[model samples]
Target: MTRFSFNQATANRWPIPDLVAGCVAAGVTRVGLWREQVADFGLEKTAALVKDAGLEVTSLCRGGFFQTPTWYEENSRAIAEAHTLGAPVLVLVSGGLPPGSRDVDAARRHVGEAIGRLVPATVEAGVQLAIEPLHPMFASDRCVVSTLGQALDLAAPYPAEAVGVVVDTYHVWWDDTVWAQIGRAGRERRIACFQAADWITPLPEGVLLGRGLPGAGCVELRRFREAVDAAGYTGPVEVEVFHADLWARPGAEILADTIAAYEAHVA
Candidate 1:
């Protein structure tokens, strides 16, 4: 059973109150919250309301940026926010190459170091840091961790229970080694979260990012599901879409369509 949840960024405009109301109305039991929205609504209040509505806080939206001297405070604050939201998994986008620094490996090391410092705080909060491997296309600016293999490698040094990986089909589907990595993640028990989106046409203004809807693209999701089931991961199949078009529609419409899509394609 793949439970479904929506990423708050999909409805970037709505307040947390409205977002929760919409998701509950649509029968969704979980959501991924962005740091900004959490702050706006105040974490404790938001958490209480979400609990009242019986919503599961799937994971926090993000917690990393391309390595930079100024990011430490920001990242630290994100960890605190994740705790405030009562989310177990904190999704990290291990930022891309910094200016004048073309060394991809160095950039990766920088992220590792940054995360190393935050391990204590995350542990204190009882939250697992989920390193999300963004698509390779965003490697230059968005995230350096672009493959499940690489994400697993980064988490290998830590206790697998505290540090794990998020498998988003939008980013990993194109990789030839994705299936193997999925199996590896399951075998290692590092698959903290699983997300879906479809590859769509007319590449948006930005690079071809997060375009898949379940069953809308060419990726064999059933096979991926098999690997996940084999590995014993029965968590929510979180729907994280950044579609420009989807954002413009009413939250109600988006929720309705998302539920329908999940049943028709991902279920």
Candidate 2:
């Protein structure tokens, strides 16, 4: 099997300690974590749990959300948490437009600026700020950054080690320009994290928990993996699924199924 890192959101209800043990049992040495959950579990405790279990926190769940008034402070804490957890990358999910504002361009610009502001902290913490572009379906409510190209554009001004983009199959799979953008990300030395999740339909209420495991939906998982490989991304491939059904299962079972899907599809 390829080196797979299970994103904790796949089994959102799993306690951090249990998730660490589950990864060890599953032979998964890496994981992607969410900030909220990390805080809930106590950052230092979660860090120690993973370290003791010999697991690597591949990337922290998120550091962005430029629209919030407290974004700077929150992201600063996220950077510190990522460092404590030994995660080299901090995923940034640019929040949606300001309340009721339709000027998406302005929001995108603000996200870029916010990221630039965070570069100093990320660089000092030895963490790469990996910007994740959500699907267009979430443009107004989730993230304004909806394309890999746009994500890369935002990261253009920062050093690759300080700011890069996440090449997640779930978000960019529907874009015909994705392959090209992956190549562009590589050329610019800006590809930080590669996340895999299949694009499923029958959207959930918020359209955030409908992602399927690698092989469970219609996305071209192997194609995306191959493209990322071709683009010079020699990094851990993280399986990050967010589905109500998946989360309802036991954590171990969910992780096992996630591994099966990654092997059959992404690996």
RMSD to truth, every model = 1.7, 1.1
Query: What C-alpha lDDT do the candidate models reach, one value each?
Result: 0.81, 0.90
lDDT tens digits, residues 20-138, model 2? 88888888898999988988999888888888888878899888889999999999998998999999999998999999799999999999999989999989999999999998988
- lDDT score, candidate 1: 0.81
Candidate 2 displacement at residue 194 in angstroms: 0.7
* Candidate 1: worst-modelled 10 consecutive residues by lDDT: 207-216
Model 2 backbone overlap count: 0
Residue 110, model 1: lDDT of 79
Residue 243, candidate 1: Cα error in Å is 1.0
Task: Report the number of clashing residue pairs per model.
Answer: 8, 0
Q: Candidate 2: lDDT over CA atoms? A: 0.90
